[model samples]
Target: MADEKRRPRPAAQYGPTAALVARNVERLRKTRNLTIYSLSAELGKAGRPITPSAIAKIEKMQRQVNVDDLLALAVVFGVSPAALLLPLEDSPRHTAEITGAGAVPADSAWAWASNKRPLKFPPGEQRTAEMEYALASLPPNAREARQHPAGRAIEAAYEDVTRVIVRAAWSVEGDEHEFIDALDQARASLERTLAELGRLAVEHEELVRLRDGVPREGSD
Candidate 1:
């Protein structure tokens, strides 16, 4: 029995998300004018190679994509992993069939997949404690920082600080003037950001109190 040849297992059936991923893979490959052979080569260069035959099987939905393959494909295609899981069409009227969520508006689906919004929230609805908690629970890098002015300010402050540090590290003795200018600019940027954050802190405290049904200070 040990010497006998092993038989191949049947292909596993995948859900709606897998089907969407497969479709996106095919569409992106064709859009970029890459053949299966070339895509396989690109994947190999990415260090997570999928054979040409397996690529065809994936496009045909004959094979399921594992997480590594998903990431490799995203790298080769120059798109975020979420992009490969979203529908190609992004019209608000069109719907994307998510496996667990049923049919969601294409725009909303994309927004949810990109972490820009919660999946269950309706448009124009006021933020609730639950929604706020959900957003807060996400990792810093995954939060929709670009959507809020304060968050963007924080990001700008971080970038300015990083730039100053990099400039300082690469500066020579004669580059003191340039380094000093960069340090001054970064300090100014941080001060502005600090002021913005102070204002936001007050606003955030009020929001938290409101969500928790606590009355404002000096309320009757």
Candidate 2:
């Protein structure tokens, strides 16, 4: 197993503010051998102009870190935000490889052939739900009814569709392509649904802006 670093203090130890977020950022970087210079350079190339000096300052807790910076760092490290947060005791050790195996690829194939399966997302169902939510948020002029109704009916309809996606995905879970396909299906469907919803919402949000001299609080 890889050497596990000492976990940091939980936010409860510091309260609702920044807490140990910076420390977690630094720790994760060190754990992955991602030097401040390398990470910041990567961030810069990715269109967020960040300097190594700035990265160092942020890690030292001398500079404030915003959500965008934190998010960029997390993505670079390929870790969940929660992992960089929420202090834990006796957290299980993480190891990326199974040792004592023959060729790694052969071992991977063997593992894939084993009982475990991949989980898939239901493209149709997810889109339906997002669309329904979007439709409900539309203004009276946008929908036949004055106010958009809750998309419960669509959600219920998509339940079975989602189930199929999940079941199918479970059949190929460990394989990267299959797993990614499952994720992509969910993401793509929902995003397209959201785009449609956003267009409709924009219309309603716009009308509210026009109706009242002062824009509504929820106005886009």
TM-score of every model? 0.60, 0.34
- Give me the runs in candidate 2 sitting further than 4 Å from their true place: 1-17, 88-220
What stretches of model 1 exceed 4 Å from their correct place? Answer: 1-8, 122-126, 129-137, 141-220
Q: TM-score for model 1?
A: 0.60
Error of 2 at 12 (Å): 19
List lDDT for all candidates, in order. 0.81, 0.54
Per-residue alpha-carbon lDDT of candidate 1 for residues 32-85, written as tens digits (9 for 90 to 100): 899999999999999998999999999999999999999999999999998789
Least accurate 10 contiguous residues by lDDT in model 1: 126-135
Residue 43 CA displacement from its true place in model 2, Å: 1.2
